[model samples]
Target chain A: MRPMPGNAAERGYALSEVSCDALLREFRKDFRIFAPVRLEGRGRFSDTDMVRYGEIRNFREMELREKSLFSPKEVLFPPSETLFHFAETGVREPSLLREDGKGLLVLLRACDIAGVDRLDAIFLGNGPEKDPYYEARRKRVVFALIECGPLGASRSGSFGSCFCVSMGTNRASGYALVLRPEDDGLSLFLEDPAFAAYLPPDAVRTSYAPSFPLEDPFPVRVPDPGDMSRAVREESLFSAAFWKDYDSRCIACGRCNTVCPTCSCFTTYDVTYEENASAGERRRVWAGCHVDRFTDMAGGHRFREKYGARMRFKTMHKIHDFHLRFGRHMCVGCGRCDDACPEYISFAACIDRVSRVVDAAASTGGDDHDAR
Target chain B: MPRDIVRKKITKNAYRITSKRAETCLRVRVPGGHLDACLLDVVRSIAERFGDGTVHLTTRQGFEIPGIPWERMAEVNKAVRPLLEALEVPLGVTFVDLDGGYPGAGTRNISACIGNRVCPFANYDTTALAGRIEAAVFPHDFHVKIAVTGCPNDCIKAHMQDFGIIGQAMVEQDASRCIGCEACAKNCLKRVTGAISMKNNRAVRDPRRCIGCGECVLVCPTGAWSRDPRKYFRMVILGRTGKKNPRMAATFLEWADEEVVLTVLRNCYAFIDAHIDRSLPKEHLGYIVDRAGWPAFREAVLQGVSLDPPLRVAETLEFSGYFYERDRVFR
Candidate 1:
């Protein structure tokens, strides 16, 4: 095992399943705990089940075996949010603030914690004005990092389409707590001192430093960020023929964007009540670049008309464009997009394809010509 | 030497009279067209040992082993006991004697299409439903043919049976989850009935046009469409292929539940018994229903059945088929 990083051993505590449940009950009083939960018979097909993020009150409710179909982003950024209500007198913003001022304790994997960091870049650090809606939820959230697997023996392939190691998102550091599921119970490493009060009084102390997966079971080759940036600067990758195949293959269902960990796009619209014409609410719903009407302007003009062009725009935003400004790629490689896609389009494979194009361009002396 | 053998008794005992004198064929009833692969060895052993080493896969999903001598009928009956015990006994089919093979062959094998266990389009398990029907009305001397199809596609040729139980999925749509991709709508328009259409960037399904094929549920990327867990069925009645009035089945019950289907099937036997011509050696179910007329047939079968609001009972049925006497029109 790797050495515990900086006093991690001092914070480690071993709790039996019984005590862990007790600790969860105590946490539930002040914080709404969210974790991946197995919803029976709620899958796309009949007699099937799906695992997604939901509110959980007990440790046993958490589904640790399978990777969630959707990322933990939904807890902070809901699918639909009513911005403000309009009336003859004035407009009033809905109070999304919790009544008890309770915080959100989310249990997620290391890759998802990294995904949240990328989301932070988009919502909070992108420009001068931070999104207030996202800031409201972000300020009251703390993470409990769930161990994906043992060091050097990750179950990434079992998770299907995961390539976090290649994207350098297999490890995370900002989480307040680390939960390692053991055969008998749970081994928790708490970073935040305040959270330690919630632990059971009789909880046994142990030397359990959380281990990050060293390698992905399903590994993909990712191009160097610098090489990707150079390819983008040349403007050759944008018009490359690699995206043309997706015109027919991709149905533009936007399922990839829906399940993406870092996709932060939203479209706002007003809904008027039937009884009162002017009295209704303004709502913001999650939108995707691949979806229709995502780029609609005032004059009925739109961008990325073709499905392949949308794919190109999304790929560049996730890998090259975001990195140019933020010093890192937007994708954390959780691979939920790869999982949720009904058309079986692999975003990881697309990244690898981008890597190949970058290498081909580099081999040809970095010319301005199209890589394809 | 020619032997004096009683033909009627042996025919009822699941043995067929072949053209070759003193030779017979043994009919093995495989309910729902599904069986344990290991049980095939029993069929193989009987063919190789007692009869000519050839097995005919019957249209009603059964095995007919030919070239067995009439004298060895007892042995064949003894050999087929294992099949009866395995396939019949577990399905709640009561047997008087374990050694006695199929007591009656007038009610043919309950056939079914491969269902949701494998096929994506199938709403429910057809084989299990077939088995359930077999348990309800089997071991009887009534000439009836029944088939179960997974969807409206009718891969099992259910339209040609006396009773066809076609599976239907009651789909529910969540507009909030819909991304207006039009995948389901376009697919429904091109392949299935044009039941779905885009309205204000959301899919609007017409219940009247929808056949409950579950194609929308299969194609929806955002899971806007889903099958209601409660299974519903559409039953078509009195279709047959014969010398007299061979006709395709017509709709009798739509959006019926499992209990309704099984009850109707059970009620059909009484309807057949009350109207069958006793003088004839055997009468097909369609001819009996035709003789009794549609109203009398419907009244008899729906005696105790409680028709729910959504469930529609056909007021009339017009069968489409050709007659042997209609050869003059063909000329």
Candidate 2:
């Protein structure tokens, strides 16, 4: 609960001297240091020691300019890993041990800070499968958030849907390390002044306003409270034509769910080698709503068959149902979905489309638009 | 998220308590007709006696008790194994085959878009292909993802998939219905061609220039412009436009013939299952074919057709439909 670095009492290195090397020296001591080191032209976050930090002298060099090519969700919840290992011996009950914990990941984006919060809500917010491995890493790490400034060029197309600015996730809070460029050097702010005192003068001190302004035109609106109950009456939603058309462009790729900030669905995999099925660990990895086998059981009855039904369930749950329970919209608008979607099936755009449809229905009929 | 809270209300009886090491898992399917309370009790009792009393919900609409001790895990199998044998649930391969459950096997590979033509974005029907493949292919435990895109916007993450089928323009159009509004030209993300010029109130289209993203069809009003009938409903396969193991789904087949596509898919599934070990994660069909040799496997499985040496994979396909991009201004 100490003040961030750059207070009158404790001043870190001068802005210029706080080169990548200096920062690495400070970071590598304990934390598994991560920073927005440049990769090719675009910026990618990686282990701090792996890249040349000298290339990152000031904030300009730091790729805090735009959304990092990837979200830091994996830092806490990886794509795949064994939660525990299970094997049987003769007559004894099979013994299971928890996975080892790798502590502290240093991610530098403001949006990712909020993204971590969202992930926490999903994984640890009272579910039966509150992954202990995820919890261990999550609790151990501190978020080092660098604010955004200007735009950088991207390798991929489909940027139209990535409007993280509208999600109010464009800044960092809680335990944060802020950097601001100054004439003398830079000012650094840390949550702990004692920790800040170790640094030389001229560190960076930075500040950020909420990216998603209240006046922003595309504020995410929560669906009607009774939309679920009323949706049943709106039988048009259940129509075959509606579903086919809506899901016509679906590629069944799990990218949206994979890149999303809050998607927590996963499947347990029992990976065995040719030599030893007994030695392989029991792994749980991220899964998505879009994937068809996500619901397939021993038998072939798919619960969310019909492309449209999957589309509708994923969309409606994000706005109407999730908000009703979580007290907030599930989406932080990372725009990853927009970028990740090969078909550009932007959920945000879909929400807007559905909203307009309901609004039109409401205007025509006295009662609320049937959500079904 | 609210429903998740409701879904989180796991009844004490619904869980099977067991250790984590159990090699086998007990999957249970609860139908709408069954009494929820009774099922919960039976499931919970089974968990208490055999499992560790904890149930994990699968993405595929079933629940499993992870970490069951290897010794007792075999016993856990007995509980649901009988139910699977009974005609009661109609278990497909395993027990708890809930209708509408997530089909993780072949579904992970193929690109089946929603019937979005019914809503707004669809250029073709996706469900028909999904159903056809589901019936024809006897897929082993393989994960293949397929994407169905109706238009150019590609809203369904089609590009980032192993198999992607995007809608394309079918034909050259008549200018009389064009309206010279620039709707079609402006809406086309790829800039299909300079043929459809609004300045002259007349437009000419280059059929070769179109990749069939279907943007022009969606924007065109008065139906002057249309997709080529021959090209409509064309199917492309075997592209892995994904981040992890990036590979393109090869277009070894075309047309929307559900049965024919099924034959090819069944063959593909057999080849993959036979050649590639399921132990190794199979990212794309092209990769598997490349490593294991496609011609040899194809000849082994596909007896009738003489195999071609040079593989001309279809990168794109065309489709026809009444298309409409959601007009932000009007809405």
The DockQ figures for the candidates are 0.38, 0.01
lDDT of each prediction vs. the true structure?
A: 0.84, 0.49
Candidate 2 is scored at a TM of 0.45
Query: lDDT tens string, model 1, B234-327?
Result: 9998898888788899989999999999998899888888889999999988888778888888988898899876799999887898888867
Which pairs clash inside model 1?
none
Best of the candidates, DockQ = 1
* TM-scores of chain B, in order: 0.96, 0.53
Task: State every prediction's TM-score relative to the real structure.
Answer: 0.88, 0.45
What is the CAPRI rating of model 1's predicted complex?
Answer: acceptable
